[model samples]
Target: MSNQTFKFKQFEVNQDQCAMKIGTDGVLLGAWASIEKQPFAILDIGSGTGVLSLMLAQRSSAEVLDALEIDAMAYEQCVDNFEGSPWGDRLFCYHADLAEFTEEIDDQYDLIVCNPPFYSEDYKTENTQRDLARFQEAMPFEHLIESVSKLLMKDGVFCTIIPFKEEDQFIALASALNLKVDKRTRVRGTINSEIKRSLLEMSFCEPARSDDKNVINTTELIIETTRHNYTEDYINLTKDFYVKM
Candidate 1:
């Protein structure tokens, strides 16, 4: 639970050099993101400690696992984490901004995942690294969507976790780009708490003409039933990574 490092069942992420440490959001996205097609290539945008890519490597037989980190410190830390991991041969980190990467990379990925910063409000902390990693201005939702539209394969799945309040707007933006939501899950901290996050899976493929609608599969996930009490669904989803789950 320290910022220095996070120990997972199959991997240990040393995040001392990174501004963003391992968190529930990344773990949830890593574990919940659909790997149904057994993606041969995967990309993780804004990989902090390379934990999300590491988790995907552990779960899938993907031959190529790439991650992108704009921050120099986090990028170096991500490369170190990936190199130390068992999937070192398969994992790689690019020290470039999303825009540059998207413009340069021509290869499309079977799956793309991003746990983006959502703090859109004008706020600043003395810690510049933390601010860059926590603020949405650094990588707006529009940029993320545009990058995904270009880098994702026609049948590829794009998964992301964002603030629940932004779910509608996010989906609308994706829809404008012809991306349709295939699956969605609203997440709450506890049974009594309001929805805090939304896990979404979208694809560029259009629905059948006969169907016309996207037919999104929606569900809800409560992380805990009470204080420190993890729900069975939550545990089942993340138990493979979190040691104590």
Candidate 2:
């Protein structure tokens, strides 16, 4: 709950130097993202403190788990976190911007995950680090999709979490790049609250040429029934990581 550190069942993420602390969005994506085939290689963009990559390392037997972090402080923290984990040998961090990494790296990953900055509001924060971590301008959706297309294997899955309102536009943009949503989950804070986030799994595989255009699998997840009252679905999905769960 604090910015200092987040202790998970299998790993501890120290975010004291990172602008974005561990939160529900990252946990949800880490736990909910489908790793059906047990990918051989995985990549986490904007890795922050490398929580997502750590979670994937705990969940799957992936041989390689690489992370990319642009911020110097966050990149250093991410490397420290990865090195301290049990899967340290299999985990690695690249301290470079997405554009540079994409341009220089030729190896493709079986899975790519990103919890990108989706806030497009016209506002400025005194903290430049927080602004860079929270603003969409730092990494636009188009650039993210383009990089994913190039860095992901042909059948690789791209999982991400974004504002629920951006779902349509995001899907459309990805579709333009031949990425189709294979699965999607609309996330709400409570049963009565409006959807706040969307967890999406997209790939290059196209839907069957059938009459039904809505081939994407869709579902909904309610995190809580009331204040601090976690839902069974949420607990079931994240019980492996969260201490309280």
Candidate 3:
């Protein structure tokens, strides 16, 4: 629960050096992103503490797990966290923004995931690091999708978590680049609350199990029945990582 470090069931994440600490959005994306393809390689974009890559390392036998972080401190912290983890050899972190990483890394990944910054371009605070980590200008949806289209293998999966309001626009952007949504989950803090975030899984084509018309398998997730009272679906989704779940 502390910003300094978060203790997971299988691994520990030291987040003190990062501008952004561990949060529910990151956890949901990390746990919900499908590895059904049995991805041979995985990439985590904007990996704040490299938690998503670490989680995937624990869940999959993937030989390569790479993470990218733009901030120097966060990148160093991410590397430290990965090195201290059980999958040290399988994990590595790069210190560079998405654009630089996208341009330099020629290899494609079977699975690519991101929890992108969504704040409006008009918004700003004096805190530069936090601004870079939370502003949309830093990693616009279009640029993100375009990079993903190039970095993803032919049959690869691209997954991300974004604000519910941006879901339609985000999907549209990905669609332009030939990335189709194969799976989607709308998330809320509680059953009574409005949808807060969208978990999206996209690929080059529609899922083989369904027709092209059925672009996505949609679902809803309510995190808690009430404060500290977790929902079964939520718990099941995160039980593998959350110690209390």
Global fold similarity of model 1 (TM-score)? 0.97
- lDDT by residue (tens digit), candidate 3, 3-83: 767999989999888877899999999899999989999999999988899999999999999999889989999999998
User: lDDT tens digits, residues 41-122, model 1?
Assistant: 9999999999999999999999999999999999999999988889999999999999999999889999999999989988
lDDT of 2: 0.94
Best by lDDT: 2
* Candidate lDDT (C-alpha), each: 0.93, 0.94, 0.91
Candidate 2 RMSD computed on C-alpha atoms after optimal superposition onto the true structure: 1.3
Model 3: clashing residue pairs? none
Q: What is the lDDT of candidate 3?
A: 0.91
Error of 3 at 27 (Å): 0.6
Q: Which ten residues in a row have the lowest lDDT in candidate 1?
A: 205-214
* Model 3 RMSD in angstroms: 2.2
Error of 3 at 145 (Å): 0.3
**Candidate 2 C-alpha error for residue 89, in Å:** 0.4
What residue runs in model 3 are displaced by over 4 Å at the alpha carbon? 206-212
lDDT tens digits, residues 1-245, model 2? 58867899988999999999999999999999889978999999999999999999999999999999999999999999999999999999999999999999999999999999888999989999989999999999999999999999998999999999999999999989999998999999998899999999999955657665757799999999889999999999999999988
Q: Report the CA-based lDDT of candidate 1 relative to the real structure.
A: 0.93
TM-score of 3: 0.95
As a whole number from 0 to 100, the lDDT of residue 223 in candidate 1 is 94
